[model samples]
Target: MESHVVKIVDIQQVTHDVKSFRLEKPAGYTFVPGQATEVAINKEGWQNERRPFTFTSLNHEPTLQFTIKRYADHDGVTNQIHQLVAGDELILHDVWGAIEYKGPGYFIAGGAGITPFIAILRQLHRDNQLAGNTLFFSNKTAADVIYEKELSNMLGKNAHYILSREQKAGYENGIINADYLRSQATDFSKHFYVCGPDKMIADINAALEKLGASADNVVFEK
Candidate 1:
């Protein structure tokens, strides 16, 4: 599909390695909360490579935003994303995704995998659609959490954080495994949005199965 150039409006570091890029949305560009677009860096030897990034902002407006976590040692597209700066230009393709909200439920995320859930949560909050929802976010450490303050303020009492490296009073000190999911989630009937590395997602799925959640209720991002 054809894409157009979007100018970077702002950039801010959300964590040690994760950054959020806000862009001035081009005319006619639109996207949904859980949708993702391919970002193409137009540098030499970078044309044919397009990387998928989820929309971080809730609204489809004049500006677009993406929160990205870069892996330094990995020789891949994410490394290129880390090197981007404001005033730079990147090509954005139309949005697409399969793992989206059918209705509010529970969100299980790990590492940099919370991007889509953030967008969905924001939209639900904005429209007063988030009456009953829970978020279980797992990261290596406190510093690894993205949008910590914002998520805390927005989700408030309904959200929980799990840090594998640091033991905090209110946070769990381990990976979000099947046992964690079984204990934290109140209703297995509720839809589950699981995102992250393969192991985390698979573990959650396995837990959900033990909790009597149907496979159809669990959605995975492609």
Candidate 2:
């Protein structure tokens, strides 16, 4: 509801179409993982559009951070965020979101949808609460996988990457389906969190029901 003026302190391209921005919060910034805030940039004093992006960093410090992936040939909010440089002042709205990590179990993420899970995984790993969690990340190509090195290092066998349009050994090359999900589950009682394109989320939700994962066991962004 409320907004504050903040500065973009850092930006790093995570992939060909993805980047991460680190912001210096104005005085007292606060937000939880999975929450999001609106940011607006202006070159002419106050003439910029605002965009909402999920907070990929845990709320533990004053500095705020977010990971964003750009759409091809698009010059909208995502592109604007990519163009930001150090010392750029922007307006940051207060964080708000009801979807969050309620512990972990089975995480199904598609492409850039892995952003929230990245932050959640880090927090869980730090707290030793990720032992029972399994992540199945789907992307168009290997190059599109964000946080690959970190996920591999932290997840060990609990993590898997699925490339839908590329062939690779060990990694499945196709849309993730009920069969594939069932193969990875050692327990049917695990909770499920599905985040991605609308179609992917819909498919995953159906698959969960087919596996007897009740409505209460599956979580999705409304």
lDDT of each: 0.84, 0.81
Per-residue lDDT of 106 in model 2: 85
Candidate 1 Cα deviation (angstroms), residue 201: 1.2
lDDT of 2: 0.81
Which 10-residue span in candidate 1 carries the lowest summed lDDT? 56-65
Top model number, TM-score: 1
**What C-alpha RMSD separates each model from the true structure?**
1.3, 1.9
TM-score of each: 0.95, 0.92
Best model per lDDT: 1
For model 1, name the residue pairs that clash: none
Which digits, one per residue and each the tens of the lDDT, describe model 1 over residues 120-212? 888988888887888889998888989988888888988889998899787888887777777788788889899999877887888889889
In candidate 2, which residue ranges exceed 4 Å CA deviation?
44-48
